[model samples]
Target: MDLEFMEAHLPLYIEAAVLTLRIAAAGILLAFLTGLITSIIKYLKIPVLMQIVNAYIELSRNTPLLIQLFFLYFGLPKLGVVLSSESCAIIGLAFLGGSYMSEAFRSGLDNVAEIQTQSGLSLGFTRSQIFRHITLPQAVSTSVPLFCANIIFLIKETSVFSAVALADLMFVAKDLIGIYYKTDEALFMLVSAYLVILLPISVIASFVERKVRYAGFGDTSTVSG
Candidate 1:
């Protein structure tokens, strides 16, 4: 019930909030690109490369992200790779988020017209151009909703950093609770912290989804069939 102590620690909460945002933003960016590339690889079936990437996605998806974070933070340094907690969290989130994001993109890529590939080939587009012009755009458009959801999931997942000793929002909130013994206030703040981080993404995602659907991912205007 030390409200004063908890109130005084507000600045610490704000700082941790910034760290959480940084981790989520940078991690999502990396995940999106990694997922996109993996999606394309699976879509095109590029032999050994596809197999390797698919195995990675499956492995990461099947395991706990907490373990992944620990490995990056604790174990990787034994191999001469050192990283700060924030860096480790970001890297772990990227891989963890990338695995699910890749699957979302895989399903989206599947939904893209098979004939679009033939159409692009008929138009004399190279493999790269077909992917660039025909496949990626539609696949991404279709994947946006799932991608947005995954981004939110990843944002929430940032709290797992506490296990790795990263002073992210959850970490800071835990400390505030311990110091002030105000469980209600600390819990409310933790909930508010995640709401602040995720609500804007939800809003923006709704807007993008509106536009994408209006443009008609299923309209069948672009494909050659």
Candidate 2:
């Protein structure tokens, strides 16, 4: 590996990583909100809206992020709706990630038994109160691992942002490789940068999963009648 070349390009990778993280963070947040809302709608079975949500979930999950980004950055301009590269990247990530997140949240919400809701109703808990107090907490706790996995998945998906002309980590690495023939160094830095970014998150996700499991959040038996 070219240590000198790697050192010189470190700042470039760092800057790219920052951009990648910013885009990922924004996208992931939007995705989480979208997923939560959709999952809740699905859980509540809101008639017409439920069908719309189902269609959206199917479309988003079935499509690839690169195609989504292409349409956002390239295709929309034909209709005079233009967005910056960053906007396209963020929106594309959110659109793709939202479907996965919805599935994760829906699974968690499904794990919540009907008897729990019945119990809450018998105890004079309002529907909103039951969802807020009993359902949301346990659902979230059960979904923590899935949530973390989705977050990491969204972060990795940021690699494709370069297709939209965003200067993300993958873009920088590929740029360096093409311009300077520093494939080995550029790839090494890319791998190292991702490892640096994802390792801690993986560790924390494992820890949180273990904690949630230990806390009996996923165990309905722990809830007293």
Candidate 3:
């Protein structure tokens, strides 16, 4: 291991780490919004839209993210829809992450008991009112752990953006290996950087999950006739 070389390149690694964080943060945000919107559309069973959303999720989940990034960055340009590498990385990450995130949200929403909806309806509440007042909170509580897990996964997966030449941590490490011939040191630091970034996220997610479990999704007591 070339400790001197590693020390000299520390600034490069730090810059790469910052860029990786920005990309991951932006990608996860996009994924959350996309997943939320798609899950709601699916939940509502909106005609035509539901089919499209399902198809999107199926295609995204089934395919490799590399192929997706290539299609966005390389393939789209053939049709005159040019996108920069960074944009391609963000969109690709969002597409892949959103599919899984949608499933998590849909599962959470499903976990909300039908009885809760029925009780609200019996009280003359509108469908929207029941969802807003009764279903959404419990669903969110149940979903928090899964949502956090997906974010962790997405953060780790941001390493893939390096394949597209996006200058993420992995890309910088790759460059260092090529330039300094210090493969062990470069790879070791790369792994350490990711651990630094992902470990806290995992811990926080577990803590939130435990809190949600103890908090009770909502009152599950049966409604008396």
Note the Cα lDDT for every prediction shown.
0.83, 0.89, 0.87
Q: State residue 78's C-alpha deviation in candidate 3, in Å.
A: 0.5
lDDT by residue for model 1 (3-91), tens: 77667777888899898888789998998888878877887799999999989998889998999988999999999999998889888
lDDT of 3 by residue, 155-200 (tens): 8888888878789898888888898788998998898888888898
Q: TM-score of model 3 relative to the true fold?
A: 0.93
Best by TM-score: 2
- Whole-model alpha-carbon lDDT for candidate 1: 0.83
lDDT by residue (59-171, candidate 2, tens digit) is 99888899989999999999999999998988898899888899999988877777778989999999999999988887888888999999998998889999988888988
TM accuracy, model 2: 0.94
Q: After superposition, how far is residue 63 of candidate 1 from its true place, in Å?
A: 0.9
**Model 2 CA deviation exceeding 4 Å by range:** 214-225
lDDT pick, better of 1 and 2: 2
- In candidate 3, how many Å is residue 61 off? 0.6
Best by lDDT: 2
Candidate 1 error regions (>4 Å): 1-6, 119-129, 214-225
Q: How big is the positional error of residue 65 in model 3, measured in Å on the Cα after superposition? A: 0.9
